[model samples]
Target: MDNLTYGIIGCGMMGQEHLRNIALIKGARVAAIYEPDAGMRAASANACAALGLGEPRKAGSITELLSVSAVNVLLIASPNYLHLEQLEEIARIRPLPILVEKPLFTDPADAPRLAALRAAYPAPIWVAMEYRYMPPVTRLIEEAEAATGGVKMLTIREHRFPFLEKVGDWNRFNRNSGGTLVEKCCHFFDLMRHILQSDPVRVMASGGQANNHLDEAYGGEVPDIWDNAYVIIDFASGARAMLELCMFAEGARYQEEISAVGPKGKIECLVPGPGRFWPAHLGEPPVPQVIVSPRDPKGPVMVEIPVDPQLLAAGDHNGSTYYQHARFAKAAMGAAPIEVALSDGWWACVMGMAAQQSAATGQAVRIADLPCAAGLL
Candidate 1:
């Protein structure tokens, strides 16, 4: 197909961000959208028109959207629980490329079926791990790959605002989101694997649902999602990754702080959230300076990761959504390979599930012991 027409499955925050980014990509457009919420559907159409992309046809149901002849590609950005079912539905219509959001599945129960589906599917299925396309994070990964002793240890920390309220409050339960680690921290896990270039062996974690949404009752049910977690992962190459996530800690200097340490040097990046004013006098506003420090503390160096001024101002992971779409478009057009593969997405979910299980049982969980780990491996 010379021109690609995308049908977005969900019109939520991520879905709308996709619409905004797709407008910036040439030869691609959101031809249709499937959002059940009437308000959100109308809002999505308005957003498209506002961006001069013209109003996208709003499909009244999933079946209607999938049947649209104008849509050549499908972008699945729906809630966690609906992903598997939607994937199954999309599979019936074969040869159409799909791009699914992170945390491949809410649970590992469907791993076997998904593996089978992948083996038989005709078109490419890519998962959206936007962090891999982030400029600073990419630079850090490149430097780590070039390090002398390889990557020894890595840490991904995010202390930011609480989870946003979804359309149905589905994010308040573990069954829906696969806990906070799977829902929100999968991106970090995928990044860890990409930087270290290894698979995880074991996971140990400690966390619980406290001080966030547990006290509130919506529809007479208390929230059961964890508000904080500290996870440690051991990879096969003796490299380790530590993730410290706190959902309630507000007003952080940076939304995400990532650092990778190797034998030769360490690379660290701090990305400020949108609208965060670090300093007016600073030459560059949002693009943070990367710090590279060698084993000897006396010698230190700094690097700048350039980002488009307009993209940095846009929402969704510091303009990563746009770059991700660019890459996806290229891959779909047979110009480049799929940057984030389905196996990597599944491994990320396995790591998250193991962490959640370990936190619940107060014991370390091995990745090889997880459900369907054999099939996945």
Candidate 2:
């Protein structure tokens, strides 16, 4: 196939990001977008123009976008709660792949229904967990592989930006956003599963809503979701992880500066995200810094990994999303195996749900009980 045409649904902030990022994808192009809301529809047009792309041919509904022959893929960039309705439609549409946003569903209760709906689809559906595509993060995986002791532990104080406050939406609420554990931290859980190469056996978490009290003062409903959470993930490999969450990072929204203590060495990923994006804004940047500080029996040594030079410039956030899109297109073309397949997404959701269930029920949820795909995505 010359190009994998994608039909995007839900034209929101992330949708606009998709509009621009898809331009860089060599194997695939966003063929159309469907919003259904007049406000978002107009916004989508403005976004297309900003990207120097022509007006998006609007679809009256999700069904219409799937009907477009050139649009061989469905990108469900819609809000968290609005996913199930679209995924059900895409499953019957054709051989198209559906790329869903994170958290999978609005509530854990919908997991089985979504899976049953997906079971009927003759096509593949994947969740858009793009974090694993981060070039430096990928390098972290390589570094873990090269080490004889393997990754024994990691600690990251992940600070997030106030996007919900700026953008204004459901991410501010606990229910519609599927609570904090599933909504924001699902990506990290998936990334952990990808890097550790081991499924978490148990998750115990604790937190309560605190930061969004202004909602009540503004006459907005108080969200029940927790603003901060401390989670402990016990992986099958005996490598346990502790996650620190505070959505409002002091200087940046995200900062790992992770310190992984392995038997042979102590590897730290202190890569700053803002500095990475600043270079993209200024059009001056180099390869990502994936430094490994190894304290081997031979003494201390630092190693910096080198990835494909072209990837270094494209801003890892957008680049990783674009890379995953390209990879999906390649998988669709039968040129490569799907890295983040439907099963992968479902498993990620199961993991997140397990954590959520554990958090809500105040018990340790076991990964073994979560459903796994008996077949393909």
Candidate 3:
């Protein structure tokens, strides 16, 4: 664990981002990769070369990648549906510390499989909740208690562009990407719990495909992923949290705006979308900000939280991916504890699934009542 070497399962858009960030870390290097697509493999090589890192060996399969002696750590950035199976495959063959992307499992029936994996997996498995590490979001989480004097309510709003086309258009369908809520909003759900310091008891939502991807047909079927949603979650601590999501509002200055309020005051953080998407004509993108409003002061103070330009250039999520990988490397090297654990990932997905169910049935969904969550509960 002195020098971290990564074995990548997928090398698509997100995987390439991970590669760039991995190159930023001092002791981390990608030794082997198992990307099925030839174009992505070439792109990953080019990215590594641009970053001045040695070329990573290309493996045909996950098993082959795991067999490499230099690969002591694993990164699973594959398709949403393939995550669970690939984890299981790794566990069966050779278990290594893993940093897996969000929306851990797609189908409800797979909960038992996850439970089994949780029981058997020996190495650290950190779920990639990159938003939690964003500079503004991190500042908000750190200062929420003192600013709010015990938060009574929390709200997270995300207004951004539609999902980009993935390899083979897999992201356009619900089945492949675990629906919009679980696929896209799990990060918000995880944030709700992290900010509230409590688990959700009930979820009520109303969302549908109002805009974007309505007419596009793939394999003779239109995409069913939702583009907008309003979700209200009742936490076990009696605190209420809300999430507002719109996938067609890329024109908005900030992609994510989070607010927490209590009897004392309110604190809010504004995070812009990826800098690469910002129009060059606009001069420069908006910097991340955290505003604190004190009830007694009668004034609000806003602080600009600028990210490292190199980190921003590495990946999206406001340089959070790099921070997350830095911490994940520490956890993998036994220097620090896993911040986002398996249970955290499970709760995040469960909350999203509950929201999706509520929206579909037009009824509030209780977390305790979901059979899929029975194992976790």
- Each prediction's TM-score versus the true structure: 0.95, 0.84, 0.99
The TM-score that candidate 2 achieves is 0.84
Clashing pairs in 3: none
lDDT of each: 0.82, 0.67, 0.93
The TM-score ranking, best first, is 3, 1, 2
lDDT ranking, high to low: 3, 1, 2
Question: lDDT per residue, candidate 2, 1-377, as tens digits?
Answer: 66777788987767766666666676455667888668777887776766555556788887787777788777788878778767776765665766777767766667677678757766666678987776666666667656536877866557654434313456667667777777777777787777778777888887666574445423356656566777889988898877777755635523554556677776555444534434345453333455555665554454544444444443346257767777777776667776776666666666667667777789887766655322222
The number of the candidate with the highest lDDT is 3
lDDT of 3 by residue, 225-261 (tens): 9999999999999999999999999999999999999
Residue pairs in candidate 2 whose N, alpha carbon or C atoms collide under 3 angstroms: 159-253
- Candidate 1 — number of clashing residue pairs? 0
Q: Which parts of model 3 are misplaced by more than 4 Å? A: none
TM for candidate 1 is 0.95
Question: Whole-model lDDT, candidate 1?
Answer: 0.82
